[model samples]
Target: MARQSLAERRRQLTEAAIRAMTRDGVARTTTRSIAAEAGVSLSVFHYCFDSKQVLLESVIEAITEHYITVVKEAIRPRATLRETVRAGFQAYWDHVHAHPGEHMLTYELTQYALRQPGFEHLARRQYELYADTYTGLIEELGRSMDFELRVPAPTLARYLAAMTDGLTLSLLVLGKDAVPASADILDTITEHVASLVGDEPARQSTEVAGGTA
Candidate 1:
């Protein structure tokens, strides 16, 4: 068999670690288990990731990237900013529901990262990535309608990001009983944002006026 390249081995090991972490949580995941799950030897695991911290960090990065991709795909070229935001949140909830273990692992790692400065920096970077994605969308919508969004894009982005994070954590802690109401909550939030940004009718009128001589 051809020897696996270093990058390929690393990717394999990282994927295995994600599975283990998701199933076992960060505190319980170990190099040996991850290697076993990946069908790689201990030596191969070490070669790919020097330590548990490094492996976990890679897992966090991988998961964050996956979520960002999902969110972007959920919003891309959607009918309106409100629809895009709602779709993004709904997609996120669906993703978490589908991968409950991975979702829980993410929350666990977030708490762990908060206590360690190095990991905290990585966590903050991921948060910024999410904020930037949402902010860009909001700014684009604002420009299209020739309406200056009341909240600064970055600030609003952060608020929305934090809101989603908080909601996810709440769902995790409270389970389906508490989270089943999320649809209603999302509707309320959408209405509130629409009110602040001006209604669809107003935006449509502005667009029509801009098109006229």
Candidate 2:
């Protein structure tokens, strides 16, 4: 077999470190174990990452980039406004469901970063990227639909971003089965948002009629 290039080896080692951190938590994940998991020698791991902190930081950057790409892909331009919103939430749900270990690692890293100034900057920058992407989409939808949203597009975007994060944390703590019924909860919240923006008259009418009868 052809030998893997330096870039390929680094990527492999970084990914293996992420998986180890995810499964074992930061405190438990060791350089020896990460090297073992990657099927590489400890010297190879050190050559690629220099240190465990460097490996963990690389993992954070990789995971953040992957999430941003996924969210962008989910909000493709062809989708309708409602579909775009749904797609964003669905992407969050799918990502967490598909990679529970990664999600846990994200939380762990976030908490760890909060304690340090340098890591906090990266974490904040990642958050700003997420906010900017979602806010731009919301603004575009508002313009296209000519709706005067109760919350400005930027604010709404922040709200939705925070909501999704809170929901994900809830799922992490409460387990998948304990997550509130998706259809009902999302539908109700969406309706409430539409009502605030005076956007979904039909839904509001139906809700009013239901309440009356």
Candidate 3:
């Protein structure tokens, strides 16, 4: 269908933009490069996105959605809140390990947006979207476990955002060498999350190991 083709074209451009941004960095990624990466003409790229900013936003959305999906999938009802938290964090780390370039590109894009004056709002909105999604997950998990977070879910989400950013940056700098030591950080988070809940354990789900959420 024409509609499906149009959507596919847009998806292709978005993916191409992500690859270009990751490989070339924001400063060097131009419309022509992205169009070439997508195997489409510059006009087709323009048809999909009015401007580079729009394309960057689309790439951000895709990357963020993938992150949320993985984290949500990673968290499930477990024998203990600690295990649940560990699973989520570990899954997040796994995703970062698997897609280091995307993780790096995310921060690159955030910084790029921040420096663009008028486009700073895009960075803010991106983080807000992350915070909101993470907060909702925390609330849902808390309700399921009959335990509330020590801090507000939004506050905890913000804390998590900072933690993940640091962890990801470490990976970007140190590469795979950072993995073993990152366990200590994950352990600290698990202990903190465990402390938030009551003694009661959550009802374990039939499926463990964080099946798709």
lDDT of 3 by residue, 120-175 (tens): 87798788877877788887787776664567677888877887888889888998
Reference-based TM-score, model 1: 0.78
Local accuracy of candidate 1 as per-residue lDDT tens digits, 77-162: 45665775678777788777667677788778878778766677656666776687678767765655444466767788888878
lDDT of 1 at 132: 74
* Runs in model 3 lying further than 4 Å from the true structure: 1-5, 197-213
Q: Which stretches of candidate 1 lie over 4 Å from their true place?
A: 116-123, 132-148, 194-201, 204-213
The RMSD of every model to the true structure, in order and in angstroms, is: 3.8, 6.1, 7.0
lDDT of 1: 0.75
Ranking by TM-score: 3, 1, 2
Error of 2 at 185 (Å): 3.4
The candidate 1 region of ten consecutive residues with least summed lDDT is 140-149
Q: In model 2, which runs have C-alpha deviations exceeding 4 angstroms?
A: 115-160, 188-213
**Model 3 backbone overlap count:** 0
Candidate 3 residue 68 C-alpha distance from true site, Å: 2.1
